[model samples]
Target: MKQRNILISGLSLVLMTSVSSVAMAQCTATGTAAGFAPQYAPFAVGGALNTLVSSINAANTAFLTQSTAFVGSPANPKPDQEGGGIWARGIGGEINTKNTVSSTYALGGNGSTFQPVATPLTGGVNCNTTTNLQFAGTQVGTDMARLNWNGWNVHMGSMAGYLGARARDTTAATPGINAGGSLSNSLEVPFVGAYAAATYGSFFIDGQIRWDFYQNTINDPIQNGLFNQKIDARGLAFTANAGYNFQLGNNWFIEPSAGIVISQVKVDPLRATGTLLLTGAGSIPNTTTFSNIESYLARLSVRVGTTIVSDKMIWQPFVTASVYHDFAGAAKAAYSESNNPAFEALSFPLIQGNLTANNLGTYGQFALGIAGQVAGTGWLGYLRADYRTGDRIEGYSLNGGLRYQFTPDML
Candidate 1:
């Protein structure tokens, strides 16, 4: 009775944290910031990839950790689950994050040289701009089935979902030159993935593969409405994980795990308007295209965690932390040119650029969860809260799931 009360309290606390974290992510995603499209546009691919990988990792870890705790000790495993058993589990959850890009810009020559120039802008707009790209969604759901025979167990699962970010900036301007002008930038992507895992004795191995289809659009309402671009991309990602478990005393155990992830993305460019902000007097080009628009990213991570068993109610609580590094994968943008008269008049050369991988530079994540058997049935339940930082992609997530154990006796 008393143990049940404590378990309930813990569950309530976890739920509250989960809700708050999600709210915060949503707020960050919708916030406004400065605009630097011409420079930052090249790096949109990195931001999209980061958000996708983070969400998938969070959901997978939450369920996998809970399943490990339920397995208990191999030496004295439960007789009702000994010979062989199968369990089915389903999880529904959400993830939120923010992706930012920064760049430096100059007006090519004089910001004061605009035709029909009003008030003759002084010195021109030469400065640095950082664009905050936000992403949020709530459809991270998964279904899995585990089969165990002897001391070996295998699990298979599938995940399907979508997330999006749209950044609009109307406040950006080069002083009095282009006031009240707006920039509409948006990115939307959908993904489907599958995973498989196997456990033998105290060692575990898991792998996942995902495909992402993305569309991005950017429009500048200023400068003859030129420089608007639409991009479509497809990406493939793969990751593998391995871990070893160690038992300490009777009710405590720890596991150390490592994994690597890689992604390859290819983008198709659509017709674009002009180069930079140019007046209607400038001849706007009908179409713009980019070549060799391909990018890649790779990362490796190490994680450590421990599970604590309770004296009553068969409750188990776990905590985990991970540190990850980015190995390589930087991309470049194709050169762009416009036949608009503004290009020759202003002496603006074709713009060619590169996008450095976000790298994330050694980010870390922490998570806490609790799982247990429900009194008299073969049902198990779990709740987890996850927080991550020190990377271009920062996220907060909450997950809850139910699993049904089919004991050998029942079979």
Candidate 2:
């Protein structure tokens, strides 16, 4: 009877120990799941901030590069022993010899009639030269992910990145301007940004905003009359888009999207290059009151995309292409140098001509990306490249990031 009692006690002891071990293992897994949320939350927030800043930097660099190509002192006769210096700073600075036309008179010799014959001449002065400016290359990076719960999908994220652009001229070598040369220029913009998206049924919409700070450099030959200048700027931009997802059959889908972007910003001038370019005067210090300039841009785009979803693995891959058109915008100066005695005679508008808004031709973009779920969470990444047939703008973007979803239960 005592042996029977001992056996029963041993079985009970083993059962209790096994149950306790299972309980501990379960608690550990639950704790890890809870802890992951806190860790990932901060990481995601920081990433969004960084990407917003990066986007702003890219926009500013593009703006400045385009402005340089459109604005500058006109070509003039070489500063020769003649009155070339005066012309270089005066009428020559205002007129592009390449596009200028003038009339001259041929005198009738004593053997012919006294009336002078009129003649037209079309040619750039032999001493006159023109230099074109452009940003040699530009690149942008962003990281963003998405979240889904119940019937709605929400994606909000950020990224940090870099963009670089160089200024080149027609006169520069085939490879174009190096780090040096008056016409050669370059800019590096560091930034951060945030983007958010929401979807209901087949309809979805998204938007992103960015802020950036940048430093720019310009090198131009002296014949152009304007000295080399450096510019710094802080900028802000916003873009919003709407689209509809059309389910094809199986896991295939197509989405058509439309979007608009509006941007506003200003540059803090380190030098009054505008004043010098117009009047051929010496460099003037840029003051907030006198040198402040404002710029605005608005653009529209349409996109078509296709998606492939794999059920075996939690992966969704997509390809999208878009075309953008600039509709309206302007860059203007607050104060006109026309009031100043030195500039009044030249009839210089207080605003630089380049600051005046004009159409920046059209451009296109192609993007490819993949998204998937990990450990019941979500993530996404993509890359895009842009091009324009004209000399206006060109660039590329690389993006990767995370996402979170809110469900009806959470709501």
Candidate 3:
């Protein structure tokens, strides 16, 4: 009887302990669910627990989808046994993509050779001149700049301030004179310029200005009478431009621009001889000086092309038309000198003359070229080559440069 009672008591005790353990386990699970819900989803309570759970799961999936689009990575925190994961990482202060800054610098030489129809003289006098001559030379130098913060699907910056030299020489041969007169002219011009632009979506607008100081000399004599004449010229020009760039498909874009250039030019011509034979030698000695100025210019341009292989490499072929209004002071001076008392008595014929006047009308220019990136941390470095033609001027220019990015972020 005693053994039976002991076994029964022990079994009762074991039963009670098992029941207590089950109850404790259930309480612990409920507590864990409550804690997670209150902290992560405070408003997701009441009888809508199932709906809340579904909504939370959808939001988590959406966040992961968006995050992976930028930096291929998995969502933080492991999923629970029920297959729903809680977002353990905070979305605060996180960047989806890193901003990029690019800078570039390039150097190159440009040259060209051409022959145009010569201007024919009417009376066919033995004036002795040449036609259909060829001329060519190169411009050597480097350009530099910088580009930055191009991440917002837009690009904006000022690519300006490049310094370089353009040296050109032309030679023409003419027969009929005692000795075939060969005329050679050379010019050296230094230029400094700047440009600014902004791009949004498929459209871009830009403007630029450049200043050139020119010095040129021509060594030619008409029938060995004029000797060699040297011209010292100085000028300042400002160009204002506005353009729109249109994107065509992938890697192709076309930009058409219109602008005006106002230029101030001064040309001083020095004669090789001083004495005026008609005025009796002593009246006029040697060295005659003539000066003139040109002040207004306007232009329009259209560029079409695309990038090669990469977004950093661009090739744009363009055509431009420009016109200038000649200033009058120089022309008036030349006329005065021709009708002077000494010149009239000596009967010295006027040879070549230039003057400033408003009657000068429109001129045209056509250019074709390619510009692209070379080497650098930014897109500021560029290499460009172009051929341009207009009234009294036709030639090819090559430009390359390096740019350093200073303030990429500007209001």
- Choose 1 or 2, whichever is better by lDDT: 1
lDDT of 1 at 68: 22
Looking at model 2, residue 25 earns an lDDT score of: 7
Candidate 1 on 1-411: residue-level lDDT in tens? Answer: 322322222122122111112211110111111122222122221232223223233223222322221221122233323322233333333333333322222222222233232331112112212223344433332333343456555555665556465543322333322232245456666767776665665677767777777676666534324244666667677766666656665545566666665655666654545424354333234332332322222223332333343442447677767665555432333323343565546644232222232333445667787766554444555766666565343555565555444441231
lDDT of each: 0.41, 0.31, 0.27
Off by over 4 Å in 3: 1-183, 191-212, 221-231, 274-291, 308-368, 374-376, 379-385, 388-411
Candidate 2 lDDT, 224-259, residue by residue in tens: 223555667666666666656566655555666566
Instruction: Tell me each candidate's TM-score.
Output: 0.58, 0.47, 0.42
What is the clash count for each candidate, in the order shown?
A: 1, 25, 24
Model number with the top lDDT: 1
Q: Using TM-score as the measure, what is the rank order of every candidate, best first?
A: 1, 2, 3
Candidate 3, residues 1-411, lDDT tens digits: the string is 222111111111000000000000001112212222211111111111111111111111111111100000011112220111111111111101001111111111111111112321111011111111122212222222122224111122222121212111111122211122233334444544444343332333434444555455444333212333445555555544445555576555555655554545555644443323432332122223333343443445555555553333323333333332323221222211232444434433222211221212333433333433322222222333433322322333333333332221210
Clashes of 2: 25
